[model samples]
Target: MTPELLRARIKGGEPLMDLDLRQLVLTPGDYAGAVFMRCDLRGVNLAGVDLRDSQFIRCQLQDTIWDGAQLDQCVFHGSNASGARMRAASIKEMNWSDSQAIGMDMSEAQWVSVNFVKTDMTDVCLKGASLKQVSFTECAWGKADMSGTRQEQVLYMYGDLTQALLQDAHWDGVVCVESDLSGQDFHGQTLQRCQLTECRLEGCNFQDALLEQTNFKGAFMRGAKLINARASRAMFVYADLQEAHCQGGRYTQSLWADACLDHADLSGADLTQSILHRTRCNGASFMNAELEYADFSYADVSRADFRGSRFMRTQFHRALIAGTRWGNKAGVLEKDPLLFEAEQWSAGRPTAPRAGY
Candidate 1:
């Protein structure tokens, strides 16, 4: 279909369906409010065109170019736009559900309140894009490059973001629940109040990042690097951090209940007022760490190093300290037999005989 014909049909309120518009160089025209059903638009270039409020249902848009196009309020349901390029497009309030957008280039695009539900956007380039209130539900975003992207209130639920490049991305209030973000690099990024619950973040690098008040509950962060990260008030309940390097990180008031930190290095970390109830910190190093007012009740610290650590007002009640090293001492709890006593003393164990013996 030629650009003039397409414009004339749209202006005439006629739907363009079942047409083969392959390799068509659509001129810069206003094709807003057009309905394109079952159309073959493969390799078509719609650069600098105005396609606002357009509906593309079950269309084949393979390798199509939409660079710098206006796609506000557009809906693309069940359409295949694989390898399509929409770079620097103004895409607002766009709904693209159940579409195949694999390898699509949307770099530097301005997206607001856009939804991409159940779409295959794998390896899509969204670098330097500005996204506000954007949601990507159940989408396959594996290896997608979102580096340097600025996002606000972005919801990424149940998406496969494995090996995705998000380095230097500025996130604010971003919630990524149940997403597979394993092995992704977020090094030195500032993620304030971000919720990444139940996500797979194993082998990911978060070194020197500011993750204040971030919720990572039930996340698989094994072997993840968090060295020098500022993660105050963060939650990691039931999460796995085994063998993870967290040396010199500030984790004040963080919760690690039932989490696994076995063989993890936490040397010089400030864990004051943090909770570690029932957590496994076996063979973990806490040398010179500030553990004042921290709770480790019922936690297993077997063979863990606490030498030169400050533990004032720290709770270690019912914790297993076998082979654990303290400053200038090792396994020397013989002097304090009452150290094994529970916080609540058992009844019927009279200290100075019954009052009415």
Candidate 2:
């Protein structure tokens, strides 16, 4: 009955604004270009409707199900869409910015060129969705379920991905910039070919993960764990890895140029052909590690430990080695006579540091 009025409104070119249409069931309607502004559409089931190019401005769309509907080019501006379900919908080119979309379900939906800026999407379920070129800028994704999603060219700039589920998802060319993903667990997950540039990854775990060719340039990964991970040719250029633990990791041919690895533990790791030019390795440990053909030119290796490490053909040109513990390390550094300095300080050197890592 109300859909007939909606059809009449569409036919008369009258905009639907400030109406309490909670009982509106938009079933089988070609109400294209329908404009719903500030309407109370809480109980409206917009299923199987052709609502293409519709505008929903500040609508009360709580618990509204638009499953299997065609809502292409829809604009949902400043709306409160809590618990709304749009499952398996063809929602292409949708703009859902500045909206409170918490707990909204968009599972199995085909979202192309979608943009969700400054939205609070906490606990939103996008599982099994096909998202291409979707950008979520400055959005809060706390506990959002994104497992089994097939995303490509997706951008997550300045977003908070705290406690987001990303298991078994196939990601291609996804870029996450300046996002706060601190204390997240990505253990044994494969994030290959992804870019996490300048993101905060403090205490995040990437244990045994495949990170080949992934770029973490300028990332702040303090106290992060990458144990036994295979990250060949990965880029950590200008990254801050202070107090990070990468023990037993395979980092062959990886670049760590100008990186801060202060107090980091890379013990028993394979760093063959890896370059650490101008890196700061103060108080770091590479004990029993493989450093074959690795380059550490102009690096500050002061007070660092490389005991029992294999250093065949390793280059350390002009590297500071004051207070460095090299226990029978098989390598000859062509150091300048002036570069060799003496350890001038140390009161009571205990078996470990005061801050027991």
Q: Candidates' TM-scores?
A: 0.87, 0.87
Candidate 1 C-alpha lDDT tens digits along 198-247: 99999988999999999999999999999999999999899999999999
Candidate 1 local lDDT, residue 270? 98
lDDT of 2: 0.88
State the displacement of the C-alpha of residue 171, model 1, in Å, after optimal TM-score superposition. Answer: 2.3
Residue 10 CA error for candidate 2 (Å)?
2.8
**202-285 in candidate 2: lDDT tens per residue?**
999999888888899999999999999889999999999999999999999999999999999999999999999999999999
State model 1's lDDT.
Answer: 0.90
